[model samples]
Target: MRLAVVASHVIQYQDPFYRRLAAHPDIELTVLFCSAEGAKTYHDVGMGTTLRWDLELLQGYDHRFLRNFGWGEGFFRLVNPGLVPTLVRGNFDAVLFMTGWAWLSAWIGFAACRVARIPIFLYGDSSYVPDEKSVRAKLRAAVMRALFGMTSAFMISGKLNGDYYKHYRADPRRFFPLPWAIDNERFVEGSAFAPGERDAMRERYGIAHDELAVIYSGKLIERKDPMTLLRALARMTHPAIAVFLGDGALRADLERYASHGLPASEPPSFPVSQEAGRPGGSAKSRAAFVGFVNQTDLPKHYAMGDAFVLPSHFDPRATVVNEAMACGLPIVITDRCGPSADIVRHGENGYVFAPGDDAALATHLDALARDAEMRARMAQRSREIIATWSYAEGVDGVAAALKSIAGGEQT
Candidate 1:
């Protein structure tokens, strides 16, 4: 089976999976990138940093970057005139639209595939979370219904995402669970630190062995709610270390909160780079703000910690949760996270607190911090859970979906 994957850009998380798909014996895959803006170093508005991915994203894959005539960043801003012609000329047996709604080029490619009578596979991470009833959402739902009708099958990321496709009237039989996974082997390998190496990492990060390290990776933006994690850790009576591993617009305010206890009036001004080093506060309540850690070095940070936390106010699906789980670290995520249901077994692997609930987050952190045995058990469970969600699983899901569609089995 020959497959063409149309995406907005080469994302660090999805690139590895695409490589695996390309390597499948029964499948020949080619990735079509709408923008190469992220190929080199660029300013990420969300991460609030001018950064370049350390790992090779385009390697080991059959891919090409389309001519982009669009201005600005993000999927909505990308415009590729060559997208439709490329799809029509690729002669692919199937075309997978990775970001149909976000990119105009993707929609054009989808239409090209439809016109060419090629099987269309719709892959997205959207979930069926309830929101305020609005005409825009309703119109979007109607658009999705039409798109679902045109597609041959759906490749869902998780249970919530599958529900979302169903809500848009996608055939349940045609929905395949191609989970949002990461490079599990790489993460596991990076996580295997020698005894002395682990100690060195602890010393370098100022994390004492006696103090439980609760790590939070990803952007320190308002949506991620890094402040809530700080407040929660401050509320804890236990001797724990809170480490924030990414940078964003909230860095200054977070640094202010870390330096002085939650401010009474407004947050004090601090340079963004100030938080890159150790922030301020009491010894027990102090938080380490290690700015952006690259993909290659992220596992070491995860390995040094007892547990991982992502207090996202709203995340489609937190891939960091999968990364932490692969590193044999239990996760403490908010209910708003899409992977919370799939990965967080609740009191088994880790706890799931309500969004924006600092007290509840503090309670869970206290439980994991005080009990080393529970943390170990939960960590083991996390590894067991994440093993099921892997790049190989996604490859198999894609192959099976294609095979079923070829055999005229898609409903």
Candidate 2:
């Protein structure tokens, strides 16, 4: 089958499921991008920037880049005039829509497919259970209900996300709960380095093996609440080392705090102390602040950790938490994180601390650090729970829905 994927970026890490859909053999895929080439990078999805998304990756897929008019965004309306004819001429079997911003493009594609007598399957923003219903969300929900009722089935991350569409009056049977997917091969194969070789690895990076390694892999900005992790670690009066692997506007402030932790003898690599605002009180522990890490090289660092922590103030759905869970790492996340709310069973799979509660975070951190048996129990559960969320399983759910929809075509 020939399929038209409706979204902004054609291929990237931000939309793993869509990318896999493109790579699937049973169907041929075409991408519809709404934004400019280099305007923004969604999540860690490097579309226009990275060559890793070369010809090899999108070999079987066709690409179409949409350009906006006069004021750029405002010109999107102009493209509407030609979008339908263009899609109709492509002779696509179906148009599969994704991304929230692609709402207009999705509408245009939907119209074109109807006139041409082709199927259209919608995905993305349609899947999530918006934390709350806003005036805009209510309108969107109404529109999606209408669109979904007419089109083929779409995908959702889980039961709750799909239930949102039904609440907004969408047909629940047509809303398939297609859980999130990840590259299982990467985690399963792992990096060249092994856990026992951590000592040599630390020495290569000029870090000490004796020092406790606390790792945080995400943006340093407030949304991620990197400060909370810092505060929690700083509050703990003990021997520990903290590593940060991401960058943003907040770099300067975080740098200052790390500098203070760096020994005076070593040329202050990080800031000595925050001039604008102190990290506040004694640093919970020693910190090593490094900028963003490359995805290919990120796993080794994750594997070389004592514990993985993400104290997001409020995250939509933490995918990296899933990555950590798959790697058998003991996690410490905040309740505000959507993934933690759904996956974390509190001391079962992993532990969840109250948002902004440094004392509570520190208590868990200290407890996990001192207790090896508890960490092992949590780690074992992590691996076990993650096995159930593989892309194969998620795709099986999607395939069943697809098969049901496509049945009786020969008749």
lDDT against the true structure, per candidate, is: 0.81, 0.61
In model 1, residue pairs whose N, Cα or C atoms come closer than 3 Å (at least 3 residues apart or on different chains), thus clashing, are: none
How far is 120's C-alpha from truth in model 2 (Å)? Answer: 3.5
Which one is best on TM-score? Answer: 1
TM-scores, all candidates, are 0.92, 0.77
Tell me the spans in candidate 2 whose CA falls farther than 4 Å from its real position: 14-26, 34-56, 60-83, 101-103, 125-141, 144-151, 192-196, 204-211, 260-285, 407-411
Summarize candidate 2's per-residue lDDT along 1-411 as a digit string, tens digits.
666766654443434454566666666767766654332343433111232332223334466666643234432532444557778898766666665334456566677878887766656633345544688878866765676667566566655466555766666666665555456457644633765676655544434444456678776777888777767767665445567766675666766755564332222233333331125543322665556666566667776666788888776566777767766678889876656645666888668988899889888888877777887898778777777776666555555555655633411
Pairs that collide in candidate 2 are 233-284, 233-285, 234-283, 234-284, 234-285, 235-284, 255-271, 259-270, 259-271, 260-272
TM-score of 2: 0.77
True lDDT of residue 273, candidate 2? 35
